[model samples]
Target: MASSSAATRELQKELEGKANDLSKIQKDISKNHQVRKKYTIQLGENELVLKELDLLSEDANVYKLIGPVLVKQDLAEANANVRKRIEYISAELKRLDSTLQDMEEKQNSKKEAIYKLQQRIQSLQAGKAKA
Candidate 1:
């Protein structure tokens, strides 16, 4: 009976630890989702900028704003820079999405384990009370 009580206490401690871990993981997942959303919004804006750049005449004057000064830049060079930026943003978004998916899976597994531990603790407590 003493051993059973000890085991029950150990299990309860483990469950509490796991619950704390699950909470931290959930917070990380939420932060990642927010970052992903921000990236997604930036991607959309980049795409719109790309379209506007495309619509510009080939010989249109393109000036890049640096600080408070506008630096003259060739239209072709500006377009290329924008294209590369868009590609980079797209790749980052893809990576962030993948990370989010993995985190969610981990979070789900932790939740399931927590649930199982709770059930086990309840069973142990009920048996202890009856005894």
Candidate 2:
């Protein structure tokens, strides 16, 4: 028969390790979320800039100060940049979600293992009492 104390200690260690790993995963998710948020803000700012430029075009004085704009690609590039930022944010969010799901599954598996160990220890004690 296995030493019950040793088994319990080993199981505890395993659980602790899994908890640490879960913590790391959570931290990674947080970092990813922050990154996504940063990109979102940048996208918003770009859109705002586009809006301001559109407004400026309506004002004769502003257009004169800016002179005849030769940069026809600014709008297109801004749109493309915003699109790229959105895609990056979406991908990062998806990655973080998947990572969280995987970590949750791992945590559940460890908990199941701990439960089984508890049941086995109980059964061993019961058998010893019966003997």
Candidate 3:
């Protein structure tokens, strides 16, 4: 009976550890989602800027807001910068998507493990009751 109790304690401890790990994984997934959202917003805004730049005449004035100042910038340079920013944001979104998928997979596996462990504990209790 003492041995059985010890085994139950051990299983409970392991379950607690796994639950903590699962919680951390969930938090990480949430953080990644927030960051991805911010990046997506930035990508959209940059695309809009690029469109506006395209509509501008070749000789039209372009200004970049640096801190409190609007510094004059060449139209071509502004266009290039916006395009590059869009590319970078798109790449980062792709990376986040892959990472999110991996995290979700891990989360699902952990859930399965926890479910199995609960079943094991229940069976052990049922056996003890019968004995």
Candidate 4:
């Protein structure tokens, strides 16, 4: 009975540890989702800026907002900057997508492990009761 109790305690401890790890992973996933959302918004805004720049005449005045100040900028320069920003954001989104996929996979495996641990604990308890 003592041995059984010890085994049960060990299993319970392991389960708790796994639960903590799962929780941390879930939090990380949530943070990743938020970051990805922000980047997506930025990408959309940059694309819109690019489109507007395209519609403007070659000699159209362009100004960049710099900390509540509008600084004059060349139209070509503005277009290039916006395009670069869009490219960067798109790449970051792809990287985030890959990371998200990996995290989700890890999360799923952790969930499965936790479920198996619960089952094991239940079985152990049931066996102890029978004994």
TM-score: which candidate is best?
4
TM-scores of the candidates are: 0.92, 0.51, 0.96, 0.97
Listed per candidate, the RMSD to the true structure in angstroms reads 1.3, 6.7, 0.8, 0.7
By lDDT, is 1 or 4 better?
4
- Candidate 4 residue pairs that clash: none
TM-score of 3: 0.96
User: Lowest-lDDT window of 10 residues in candidate 2?
Assistant: 57-66
**Candidate 2 regions off by >4 Å?**
56-131
Clashing pairs in 2: none
Give residue 62's lDDT in candidate 4 (0 to 100).
Answer: 95
Model 4 lDDT per residue over 1-131, tens place: 99988999999999999999999999999999999999999999998999999999999999999999999999999999999999999999999999999999999999999999999999999999999
In candidate 1, stretches whose alpha carbon ends up further than 4 angstroms from where it belongs are none
Candidate 1 per-residue lDDT over residues 1-131, each given as its tens digit: 89889999999999999999999989998998898898888889878978988999988988999999999998888889988988998899889889889989988999999999999989998998999
Candidate 2 lDDT, tens digit per residue, 1-131? 35755665675676567667656756765775687677667657756755665555432332111365533345445445556765676676677668767766776676676567667666766765676
Residue runs of model 4 more than 4 Å from their true location after superposition: none
Ranking of models by lDDT: 4, 3, 1, 2
Candidate 3 Cα misplacement greater than 4 A, ranges: none
Candidate with the larger TM-score of 1 and 2? 1
lDDT of the structure predicted as candidate 1: 0.90
